[model samples]
Target: MTEEELRQRVAVAKKFMSALPFCHALDMRIDEAGISEAVMSMPYDPQIVGDPETGVVHGGAVSALMDTCCGFAVNLHPECVSPTATIDLRMDYMRSAKPGERIFAKAHVYKATSTVAFVRAIAYEDDPENPVATATGAFVFSKSRKAGKGKAADKSGAAA
Candidate 1:
């Protein structure tokens, strides 16, 4: 992608992320974004602790992070000209995240068709090789999002 295109995609991703209320509540931040990949981070917060005794972050928070990261990856894909939503997401927990450590999720779009995008993601506190969880997901593009424009297009290519 050209530098201008990359900048545009990044700006779009950041704007989308900022608009999500849940993202703001979770304190999620964009670390990096590329053509078909995205890295996001969330700080460990006591409010989201699953185990009070251990102070481990909740699985739901991690799941949200992975899902959002996957969607972000799809939005950055060259073939994905429209907004996207998660169709399916499967997460496998490997271990608990360390207390007080910021969690990170890195997601990549492995495949993109006309309707759907396939993504893989890993969540970790420090070492990605030793992930806290791994996720594989599919995202579907919005039918209302028109090609090369912001308005919805009909099957006959007219604006809806």
Candidate 2:
């Protein structure tokens, strides 16, 4: 994709992030976005600490970040035009996030059909080799009938 097109897609992801109340509460930010992948960052906050003694980030927060990151990647997929809803998402918390460290989730959409998209993501604080969490999910295009430019059609050329 052209630089300008990528810029626009990133802008859209940012706008979408800003509109999510939960994301805003966690200070989620889009670090990068392209046609098939996205990276999102969230800074450590005392308000979200689940363990007072350890100051570890909550599992819920990490899961949300992964989910949002994966969704953003799916949103920018070349074949996925309309909004999508998560059909299934499974997140495994590999480790706890360190205190006062920013967490980032990088996600990529690996496959896309007319109606569904598959995505995977890893959440890490500093080293990508040791991830805090990993996620795999599938999102389906909105079943709404509203047609648009990038809408995928069925074999019969009808909107799916």
Candidate 3:
């Protein structure tokens, strides 16, 4: 992709992440975005600890991060011109994230058809090789609604 296109995709991904209420509350940010992949991160917060004794981050938060990263990848895939909704997602937790560590999620859209997209994601603290969790998911392209002038159109064909 051209530099301008990459910048545009990155902006779109960041805007999407910022708009989500849950993502906003978690203070998620997009570190990088390309035509088929994205990287996002969320800072560790004591309020989101699942195990007070170990200070482990909550599983729910990690899942959300993975899901959002995967979704962003699908949205930014070059072949995808419409919005998509997650049809199914399966996540595997390899281990708990260390306390006081920022969590990073990287996702890639491996395949995309006219109707569906396949994505894989991994969550890590400091190293990508040792992932805390991994996920694979499918998203369906929403053909029912179209986009006009780079803006999403509602069911009634109005800008959303």
Candidate 4:
């Protein structure tokens, strides 16, 4: 991707993050974004702790992060012409996240058809190899929107 295209994708990712109330509540931020991939981070917070004694963040919070990251990956895919919604997501928890550590989710679009995109993501605290959870998901995009000359079109059918 060209520098301009990368900038555009990052802009769109930031806009998407800003518009989500849950993202704001979780303090999620984009770390990097590219053609068909994205990385997002969420700081550990007491409010989202699933176990008070252990201070582990809730599974639901991690789910949201993975889902949102997957959506971003789909939205930035070259063939995707519009915004996407999660059709299905399957997550496998390997272990509880370490307390007081920020969590990061990295997602990539592995395949895209006319209607659906397949994604794989991993959520980890410090090392990508040792993931706290792994997820696979399918996202659906609009058939009505058409891809623009050099960029994926938005839901309004305009180049993003």
Best prediction by TM-score: 1
Candidate 3 vs candidate 4: the TM-score winner is: 4
Q: Considering summed lDDT, which 10 consecutive residues are worst modelled in model 3?
A: 143-152
lDDT: worst 10-residue window of model 2: 143-152
Q: Report the C-alpha lDDT of model 3 over 46-154, residue by residue, as the tens digit.
A: 9999999999999999999988889898878765667678899899999999999999999999987657899999999989999999999999864323323343333
Ranking by lDDT: 1, 4, 3, 2
* Local distance difference test, each candidate: 0.89, 0.85, 0.85, 0.88
Q: Which scores greater on lDDT, model 1 or model 2?
A: 1
- Clashing residue pairs, candidate 1? none
lDDT of 4: 0.88
Q: So what's the TM-score on candidate 3? A: 0.85
Q: How does model 4 score by TM-score?
A: 0.86
**lDDT tens string, model 2, 1-160?**
6788778877876887799999999999998888889999999999999989899988989989998999999888765567777899999988889899999999999987667889999999988789999999999854323344344334337633
Tens-digit per-residue lDDT, 1-160, candidate 4:
5779778867976887799998998999999888889999999999999989899999999999999999988887866667899999999999999999999999999888767899999999989999999999999964334444333344336633
Q: Which residue runs does candidate 4 get wrong by more than 4 Å?
A: 142-160
Cα deviation of 130, candidate 3, in Å: 0.5
Q: In order, what is each prediction's RMSD in angstroms?
A: 4.2, 3.6, 6.0, 5.4
The model with the greater lDDT, 1 or 4, is: 1
